[model samples]
Structures are given as structure tokens and as C-alpha cells.
Target: MSKSVPSFLQNELSGSVMTMYSGDYGGVEVQGNIQFSINYVQKLREFHIFVAQCRDLAAVDPKRGRSDPYVKSYLVPDKAKIGKRKTSVKKKTLNPIFNELLRYRLRMEHLRTQTLILSVWHHDTFGRNSFLGEVDVDLSKWDFDHTQMNYLALKSRPTSSLQPSDDRGEMKLAIRFLPQVSHSPGKDPPSNKGEVHIWVKDCKNLPLIRGATINPYVKCFVLPDMSRKSRQKTRVLRSTVEPVFNHTMVYDGFRQEDLKEACVELTVWDRDKLASNLLGGLRLGPGTGRSYGALVNWMDSNADEVALWERMMTSPNEWVEDVLPLRMLTTAKTVMK
Candidate 1:
């Protein structure tokens, strides 16, 4: 079907209207549209998107005959780098109201070439999920500094595979490094070693599982060697999206030079009876070569992460506290074991 450009968007487009599709489930057709808001916070260098609601969705259920729909969104071209974000599934409803916020850490220059992709899906419990429809918007054309609300029409999936977004949640932390140096004139200088104090403060906007809240915890590790000895965790908070840790861990016995290569990794996990699920993680360190000071370079394009690294390197003796936004691992290999 030919897509119709909304009158409000006509001025934004030069001469061609963007193509969109109506969602079709088996033979049952429905007119679907998504309502959302977008804004970029300059101080944080992040894009915040709120998926408010989706209406007139196609029913894709086979046995019960009602759809359990959820919305997944991501930035195009570098979908693998930014990861994907998703809303909770609303059971047996064609009109699902998510009201969920997703965030992406990106620079203003990088936003000029990026596109936003939002997809709706039918989540099946007993079988594989089915894709209902999607919407792609050229973010470069939009004014991100000013908040904008959009009612976008849904279309068929642009590609076969979908990359998940980084809407899971975020962690708050305070990192301090104390160098082992002698103050007394006569006393021998202490060994070339220091202590790293890490405080896992809290978490926010965690994802839901099976319509219930998660038991969230923070896991900390000193990287290069993510061995069992270096791993420490906070007590799991029961049934809450916003979890308060306020726990501190100290890593001693390492030269001041270790700051150049060593990094502190903090991961959030949902504590399950059998196996815990990885929610997201944050990495802090010094930039090496072309790599962004943290998390494999590609993930640390935001100003905050790079600034934190600069502070640590330039002022190793002073304490630094930063509210580091957490992001999901782009690939399975990046997941914290």
C-alpha cells in the first residue's frame, strides 16, 4: 500500500513522502500507528525517547486469537553499536500503552546521519515471536534540541533481523582512586600501589519479566582479568525496578600505572532461581589509542564517559562521582560472565 505523509510532516520532506505499511496478521488487517516523544539532553549528550502508546495493532495469536504486543526501537546504520530498547508486552490488547522511556548516548555530530527504527511485535510464550510492523524516521531532519511528539504509521519490517535497544536501565556510581604515596619526609615512600573504591549507589527504570518486576543486583569487576576473585555483588533487592545498593567495594594492591590499562566494570543482573539474566553494564577507564576510554570504544561515544576517563587520568588522587548510564551488551561475547 502507498504511504500517506501526514500534513504536519509535509514541510519536513522535500518532495517525496516516506513509505509506510499497514500491519497484517495472517489475513486480519489493521491500521497501526505509534505515538512517541523525542528529546536530546545536551548536558548528558543523550537522546531520550518515550514510547507512549500503540493503537490499531494487528492480532497475531494462533490459539487464543489475541495478540501480546510490545514495541522495540533502535537507531539505524549502527544498530549493533547502540543496541535496542523495548517496551513491556501488553497481553490481549490491540492498543498497548507502554509509556516507557529509552535513552541513547550519542553526540550531536553523530545524530546528523542517524535514523530511528521502531518495530512492533507479537510476543508468543510457547513459540517464537512474530513481527507486526515497523516505522523508520530520519532523525537528522528532526530538531532534537526541542522536544517533538510524533504519531508515526507502522510498516512491514525493513529487514529480517532486529537489533535490540539499550532501554534496560542505568546504574549510579562513585569511583575514587587513592595512590600509595608517603607524606612524611623521613619515612620511606610507600610501594607504587593504590586502592580503588567503588560505590554502587542505585539503579533506575529496569525492564520487566513475565509481567512482574525483577530482583536486581549490581556486580562489580576489575577488568583485564575478570576472574572470580575480582567479582563482587550487592544484595538483590526484591521486586523493584529502582534498586538501592549503596554498597562499596575496594580493590587494593596495584601500581598507579594500572590506571592506564585497568578498568572498573559494573553490571546489573536479575537474580533468578536458576540462572541470572544480564540487564546491562558500565565501564570506566582511560582511553587507549583510538579507543574511547571505556567499553570497547564504540559504546563510549557520549561525552560523560569520555570526560570521566579524563578526570581519572588527569587527577588520580581526587575522588570522582558520576551517574554512569548503563547499556546492554551489543553482542553475546560482550556480556559479563
Candidate 2:
């Protein structure tokens, strides 16, 4: 179930995944129109993109009669996984109704520097995905307050080295930074110590151990400090796939700058008596590949995780919550980097 991509698309996507925004409207036929709406809510400081549908799309596979089209999007100049958003594939159809919402959390000033590019593709199970068409929207031209579908003409939009979607279940939680200042008249003047609240509500669609139920528990570590002192765990809920452990792990003595430098790694595991089985986990941080002042490998948070963290960091005392997809872990290596 594979198809060769168009030569032009292959050429454009060769050396890079998507280095667009260079006015490279490479010669591509106008084959479709995408319907989507844009809205910006000031309270949450997030931009919500409602991708409605696509009509009269081109059939790349004429013998197959239609295409397996899906939408891929991201903000320009920052293709870091945190900025990318995608929709599920619609099989063998010329018009796909995708009532999906893609969100990005950022302040107004940061949004101005970015361009939103939404591209359509034909998904191939074993081969490279074929490019269909795309629409690049200027973040400033549309009215942010009102919600109305924009029928943008899809055109030749170069390339995107894409990755297939994964279903490793999702974790829901709330994060908040409550800045603290203590005054005892003498001692140590004043410190910018703050408390980070991570409320692990529960997990949905957890996997089983071996055709049997799993006793799942969650573990947390505020990173750069994966020490024993920083290791915190929640009680295991037995014989359940979807476990609800209304637990909160609080890490204190962190300054305002420390929040910017630190990453939160939360993992799900099956407590087999004294031993453990790794189900999956997620990292919440800036996803910069480097943290503090050094180069490290643990800053692997995706766009959704980064957005949730950014929302919590910017909102200060407010509780920012989101459901983030967990990454599946296969092996329990000697150490986690």
C-alpha cells in the first residue's frame, strides 16, 4: 500500500523537512480548497484553528479513484515538533470533512512573528506521503474575535518531511506556578522560591500488561535533577486500564528563572510488586534540546506539551490544564538521558 511521490514535491522536500516562507510557490496545480476558521482567545492567550473540511481535492491515485488526505500545519520559523499540528487521514474520498481543532499557545507579540501554513497530503502506509496542496494564512489579516470559516484556495506550497500519527493514549493534568516570598525579619533576606503544582487527574486508554489488567501508577521528576530526592510517585490503582488517581505532586524551592530552565518528566508504570513495567510517559518543557546552559538529551517535549507548559508559565498563578498524548516506551534502559 505505497505510492511514489510526485517528482517536484520530492525535489522540494529533499534536503529539508519544510524550510518554507522563502516565496517559493513552486509550480503546482491548484487542485483544492480548504475550509477552516481561526480564533484567538485573549484570556488563555491561545490561537485556536478549526479545520472544517476540504472540497474537490485532486486524486493523485487515479487508479485508486481517490486519495487518503490529511492536513498538516505549523507556525513558520519554528518547525520544532511543538509547533506542528495534524489531522487524521480521510480514506478514499475527494471531499473530507475534518471537524478538528488545532491549538497554539503564545502571547500576541510572539504570534506576530509566525506564519500559519496548512498543507494537505495523501498518506501512504509504507511510502512517502504525496503533497496535494496548501494554504498559508497571515496571522494578522483575519479578525481574531469572530469565528467564521475561511475558504482559502489551496495552491502549490512546497514540501514537508512528515511523520505519521501515533496513538499512545493521553494524560490529563493541570500545572501552575505559585511564586512565593518569605519574610522572617532577618535570616536569609528574600528568595524567589515558588511551588509547581502538577495535578495528575488520570489517564485514558492505558495498555494492558499481558492480556491482563495492569496496576498503573505515575512517577514524576523535575528535570536536570533526576535524583532520588526528586523522585515522586503516586499510589498504584490495580486491575484497571483507565486508572483515576486524583493525585498532586508539588515541587517547591524553585525560582522564576528555574521554571524556565526546568523540565517535568512524568511516567506511567505497572507496579509488579517491587519491580515495575514502563507503560509510557511525557516530558513537559521548552523542547529546545538544551536546558539551563548545557546541551542535554532530555528536552524532548513536543509542541502540545510545550504549549501547555508555556500556558502555565505565562499565566503565573492560574492553573493551566491540558490532555497530552503519552509517548510509548519499549525498554527499561539502565538510565534515562
Candidate 3:
């Protein structure tokens, strides 16, 4: 079955904005022997495969177990409903295709020594096209100024053995990756079979509309956030992210008690302009803007009630025993124990 243009979204592409940028790879051939670059193709393919994985996600029960998992939230048709909100969700078990998406999104959001736009592009000094974005201080490049970085920095491991067995019992190639430490080089060395998997969900039988690609699922795990109160005391904090790949996510890992005890602490910084030398320099986009506003709003809401705030502003305390509320002392002790 050849994939047809989605009838629901066909009108979205009718206007001049849509037409000016040819979405198809072949249609937008330009000078410098550049079509869409390999990086773009890889991202496009991963996104498409994500859609294909949801086909299975839609068929299963999300709450039952980890069977067809994919980070299905973003793919939730903008109109669909989950709970009280119109959010994207699919019913399925642990699907690798979706899991990879979740891992990357979480990793990108958490590791922020600096910020970068993942999907945006830029042109080169030689008049060639390029991806435009910045890397974290951990990652360096000579083209930091001219080249904008895409969100996807790590190259995916490619091979047939990477794909997991699909809904139809067909085994495909797919690869799974762990976040790299700073010392690891750009080129990732391959591992043994089943270490990674890929499931290209494109049916050759279908016509050449955009085909869906599926990713292979490896394991279900949590990314831990480590915080240190002092040089002596360290805390291993765990946050529960609703799995992006699998929307019908319900697990015992995060309990009602955890929810009751969990509260995010915000630190609001006044907006500061970027240095002229830096690319795009300290501009706030939607994420930073919202974060800034949210921090300000929270401070505004609780400015007077929060104790130790004014004192801390004047002096950084070495021994911090005075900040606790009487109500939370018991609860805090129980939690720590």
C-alpha cells in the first residue's frame, strides 16, 4: 500500500510558505551538489519511522505493560485527547523506535551547560548550505561561528542488525545508543549483534509517498539527576518522564508519594543580552522565555513567604540548618531514610 498524502493536512501545504520550501528531498536540489544533507535525511527518517512505530502503538494497551513503546506524545495528532487535554498518545508496548526519541529529547533538555537549536539550519561562508546551531562546551568545532548546529549531534549507529522484530514478526535492522561522555570521539565504533537494532517500517509494496520508519527498543530505564547540597552531602534525584515513545505509560517506579513530595525549585534570572561576538548571543526563544516567565511568576507568587531567601541574597550561608519548616521536618527525615 503506497502511502498517500495525509488528507487531513494536505491543505497545510497549499500556501506559498509551504511551496517555497520544497519538503521533498529530490525536489529541492540546489548548487554545491547539495540536496538535503545526510544529517537532515537521518532526522527525517527517524521522524518518519517514529510515525510507523505508532501504528503498533495505536493497536495495543499502554497501561498493560511495556510492549509497544515509542515516545508517542509528540506524534499524538494535535487534535487527539489524552486525559483532560487534547494531547497525543498511543496504546502500545515498548517500541524501540519511540524509546530512542524519548532518550534524545530528555538528554537534550537536561544537559545544558549551553543551549542550541537542534532542527534549525544555516549557510556556510563558501555559500554552501549547512546546519546552524551551537554545541555545548563539552563539544567543540572550528565552524562554531559559521555553522549552526542541529539538535542531533551524535551520529546514529547504522546496520541491519539494529532493528528489532516488528509487529508482523519481521526482524529489521536498528541501533540503540547511550549518551557519550566527553572523551568519546565523533565516530562511534560498532558493537556486537543485537546491541542496536533498526526497524524501517516502510513497505516496499506501498507507493513512494513519505514512508514511515520504526526504531528498535532496547531497555526501559530512567535518567538520574544528581545534585549536591554541599561537598559532603550528595543526592541522587530521579525524575519520571512520561515515556515519549509509549504514551499509555503507567509504571510503579514513580509513586503517589513521590508526586506529593516532589516540588521543583526555581531560580529566576533577569534577562541578559548576549555578547556581540557569540552567535545569536543570549536571545531567549520560547523555551527560555517560558522558563524565565515561569520563574518570575513563581517568585512573584511566593516572594514574601519564602524564608532564607533575603538572607541568602546578602550572605551565602555555610551551615544551612535554619531554612526548614516544622511541617516538613518529619516528612524530610522519612524520605531521606
Candidate 4:
């Protein structure tokens, strides 16, 4: 006898597989299914997901009396191994809460074919890590622009493994481009050459450290020249998520035409005694408004960054402001460029 499927599942899997097995034939019994959905947002330039938390996790370390768990997520069809992210380790716990956000710079047309893979793992100090369970979600089935929180029951890791959360915080930015216009002898211009001014205002909803606020800072880069001289960073704000750095960085010798070939990349990082952890980053260029041409890594095309630069070149006098949400830095292949 065929079991009746739920209306929602029936509608979604209309032409797909829908089956039940009989125990008399030695078929395996289905105990339960995981129930989790991602809260996703499609921005003009990127796809964002907020991985809230996991509940009722299965115990993978019963021998040790408890388990230290963390969540690893990835976006599938990533042959280059670029779309992967991990949450901070939560020690000795069954239910791990990871209020973390993940992002990918994918085209809208290609988004429907993507799949999101989330797995829970048991971390070990001296030995290999253990995989507890996993979940796979189809990006095409998710509703865009709305927040959906789901509780997924742990499931066995699938045989064919592929790959890969949301807004924990937001940052405000102000940008202005000054052109080099000739003026009268008596009246002096602001300077001889042009300049680009960037102001890193403040951030909100930053993740906490040990129940206390985090010391955050902003780093700016004018790519494809990532040299030390081309990079600028703000002073680390002590013990606060919302740090106001009305700080302004002036890039001298900035030409109006440079906007056509150049981009501004801002990344947020948490200050630590040893090594700072990247919080999130934003990239702005002419390509941002029209195409993602300049957004691709320069090494991929074996060409200069100027060849693909495209959007903000037309309006030099107009000041633009962007409210960017910060997401965790994932795989090196994804964020290195």
C-alpha cells in the first residue's frame, strides 16, 4: 500500500520520487527526517544565509561523556572548492547555537541550480574530527527576501557528498570621489591631484566574544594592487561592536578614470593578540552596478583589473552610501581574491 504524502511535499515533488517500503520484503524503516530551511536573501551582488542554530543533535562522543560540536556549511556545484564556511566551535554540547552568516557572490541566473550543504561535526583535539550528521537544501525551493528559521533533525551523511547563513550584523559606508579641476591662481583647489575619500561609520549586531563585546576594525584595499602601500586600515575600537570611526582615508593621485578600472574592498576583522579573524567584507566597483566583470579574480582572466571595470565612472560629484551586511570569510579560494 502507498502512503499518502504531505500536500507541501506532494506539490514540491510532483514529478519526483515519492515512495514507501514494506517491512515484509526486508525494506529498511524510515525513522525520521530532518526539518530545516535556510533564511536567505538575494542581494544585488551576493547571496546571503543566516545559519541560526542546531537542536536535538545526536551524541557522537558518548565515550568521552560529551561532544564538542561545530557547524560546517558549503554551496554545491563548487568544483573549484570555493564555497565553504564554518562556524566557531562550541565546546562540550549537544545543541550548538551558531548565530552565523554566510555569503557567496553568485549570479542570479545561476542561483537556482545551487545546493546548500550543512553538516555538524564533532571536534577532537588530538585526533581526526568526526562527522555527526548532515543536511542538504535545494536553493531553488527557498523563498527569497523572507526570513525562515527551521529546526532540522540530524540525518546520516549522504553517500554522494557535495558542498556548503545570514545577517548577524550590518555596516554603513560613505564614499566620495574628488576630481582634479583646474582653478584660478588666487583660488587654490583642494589639492593638485584627485582623491577618493572613504569613511567607515559603524557596525551593528556583531558577534560576541566570551559574553563580552568584540574589538572590531575595518581594512580597506584598492584592488588589484593589494600591496601594503595600497591598503589602509582603521584603528581597532576597543570592546564594542558599534565602533564609530568617522575616520576618512584619502587615496592621493586618484584619477576620475580610475573608477572605471578600480574597486574599493572593505573588510571587517576582530582584533586578537595572535591573529585577527575576518568578520566580513564588501567590494565596490563599476561592475557592481551593471555586471560582475571586475568582481572576478584578476588571475582567472590573466588580465588587468581595468579590462573588466564598469558602474561608478559616470558620476564623480555624486556621493554614494552603502549599508553592507558583514558575513564570515569562507574558503580561501572564495575570499583570497
Best by lDDT: 2
For model 1, how does the per-residue alpha-carbon lDDT over 189-278 read when each residue is reduced to its tens digit? 775667778888888766665446689898876655445688888999988878988999988775666666665667788988887887
- Tens digits of per-residue lDDT, candidate 4, 87-138, equal 6778877766778776666666577777877776766544335666777777
Stretches of candidate 3 exceeding 4 Å from the true structure: 1-215, 223-247, 253-337
lDDT score, candidate 1, position 167: 50
TM-score-better candidate, 2 vs 4? 2
The lDDT for every candidate, in the order shown, is: 0.66, 0.71, 0.18, 0.56
Give the TM-scores of the predictions, in the order they appear.
0.52, 0.55, 0.14, 0.46
Better of 1 and 4 by TM-score: 1
Give the C-alpha lDDT of model 3: 0.18
Q: What is the TM-score ranking, best to worst? A: 2, 1, 4, 3
Candidate number with greatest TM-score: 2
The lDDT, on a scale of 0 to 1, for candidate 1 is 0.66
TM-score of 4: 0.46
Per-candidate Cα RMSD to the true structure, in Å, reads 14.4, 13.8, 26.9, 16.7
Candidate 1: segments with Cα more than 4 A from true spot: 1-77, 80-112, 116-164, 181-189, 287-303, 330-337
Q: Report model 3's TM-score to 2 decimal places.
A: 0.14
Per-residue lDDT for 1-337 in model 2, tens only? 0122212221111101222222213322449799999888889988788999999888867877698888877676563333456788999998999999988877777777667888887766543467788888767665566698899888875455433233344688999988874557577656568788899999865655455677999999877665677788899898876788889998888777776677888889988866888777888888676555555556667668887888988998899998776665321122332
Of the pair 1 and 4, which is ahead by lDDT?
Answer: 1
Model 1 worst lDDT run, 10 consecutive residues = 10-19
